[model samples]
Target: MDARYAIEIDGLTKRYGSMTALDRVSFRVERGELFGLIGPDGAGKTTLFRLLTTLMNPDEGTAAVDGLDCVASYRQIRSRVGYMPGRFSLYADLSVEENLAFFAALFGVRVADNYDLIAPIYRQIEPFRTRRAGKLSGGMKQKLALCCALIHRPSVLFLDEPTTGVDAVSRSEFWDMLAELKAKEISILVSTPYMDEADRCDRIALINEGHLLAVDSPRGIVSAYGERIYTLSGGDMYALLLAARRLPHVRRCCPFGAAHHLSVDADFDAAACRRQLADEGFADVALQPAESGIEDVFIKLMNHE
Candidate 1:
């Protein structure tokens, strides 16, 4: 029960009959830090968020938010935390203003009470105050949901895949809003499947199949990639992928954008690799050394697991 940590979990486990959704997962989020749970669907991110927000109980282990026990002090914890679920959970029939007002009332606070806190976000959607939430676009709905979440001004905010199904412009705007919220000293725990979003967090936990693969700053995680990687393009992508995988020195190869990123052993020979591909009748082969990114590290970890 460290008072300094905004959120803490130790050996947290959850089971659905024989299926383990979260297995001995553990992590700490410092106060005011923007921490990301980087994982794809079914990675236990939603389950973990539910456990921390006191909406669901963990089968084993313990968790706390803002020094309040998740199970024992759930009432208090609920009041101290704001949660935005992965799917749009707000009332679809209700107008944007109505939704915000209802949530504010539920917390025994008025939207005006925290007007300054949400003004930056609300202003964008204020023009559509009378529009039904269901009628709004993905991005507008996202903004409205955030306004309702912040109405009570909770110390810690939990956003579960808030950016999913959103447009690129809206996604970028949502992160910008999160950055502003973080600047206000509100600890944020956001989960996303996008690897690019991992770079925006102060720190991230890479999880897959109910296990935490790694937790560190984005740069730190990238630095943990130990193998030499090369990018190869200019040939038929599928053919190039098969060819690269067959190479003895190639440890792993996966399609990345227009190029295929291949991991190799220390003794990897660039000239020899090109010559071999040419001999295979692949035309216009191009290869060059490239740096590893979060996706690369994630692939490496998943393979080892």
Candidate 2:
């Protein structure tokens, strides 16, 4: 393992009977970096996190965390890595404080000893400390789960879709907390289905259907987009899409927000496209050049595969 690598995975594969969950997946996460495993559900993001956290074993290949083998040194890795699962796995009947204390005890640490580590997060939900984990709001549950994960003061933190069901404000708050954690030099590996969240990571690995698609910074992936993207919006968008697709240079057109983002061939002309749509009896067609984001790159990569 290179000295810079906090997590090293090579040719990692996992199978569930005949179903392949991961296929020769490989990547490296630098120490203290905020890395993301980005993809939609069933993209093997959870499986890869499970393998690195030592929750399950890979069928083939190997991985290491901070120089400890995931297979051979699972115990050491477990002690050194903090994991927040995709789902709410903490005890529901227990109060918020109780749940956090339980995890700390299991890790052979006291809540008081590591209280400062999770203080920032726990403080938000502190007033609800007496509330049962099940009764807490979606965002509160997320915060409590995170507090439990960090109670041990692990060197590396693995969060599996920590912001899935939370509100927008809470989601923003959670990412802010991650930034603070990153500053503390705690290497973080977070998985999310949200393409926008990819930008928050230092580097990202885009995966889909048990295969690796692209691995680079969010900007790099967006820059990899080979063609220009135009956002077209007008009355009867569905009809407009059909008309635009019939144009000579149209390569790919998909709904994005309230508009359709069209990728065109080199010979594609924006003026011609507008005219083509207008000539087709479409109402008030509009086209504006737009930048390719992570989601656009993801869709294009999945199509190629």
Top candidate (lDDT)? 1
Compute the lDDT for candidate 1.
Answer: 0.92
lDDT of each: 0.92, 0.89
lDDT of 2 at 243: 77
Candidate 2, which segments miss by more than 4 Å at Cα? none
lDDT by residue (tens digit), candidate 2, 171-203: 888999999999989999999988889988999
Which candidate number has the best TM-score? 1
What CA root-mean-square deviation does each model show from the true structure? 1.1, 1.3
Candidate 2 overall Cα lDDT vs. reference?
0.89
Q: What is the lDDT of residue 182 in candidate 2?
A: 94
> What clash count does candidate 1 reach?
0
- TM-scores for all predictions: 0.97, 0.96
RMSD of 1: 1.1
Candidate 1, position 99, lDDT: 99
What local lDDT score does residue 234 receive in model 1, on the 0 to 100 scale? Answer: 87
Q: lDDT of model 2 at residue 221?
A: 82
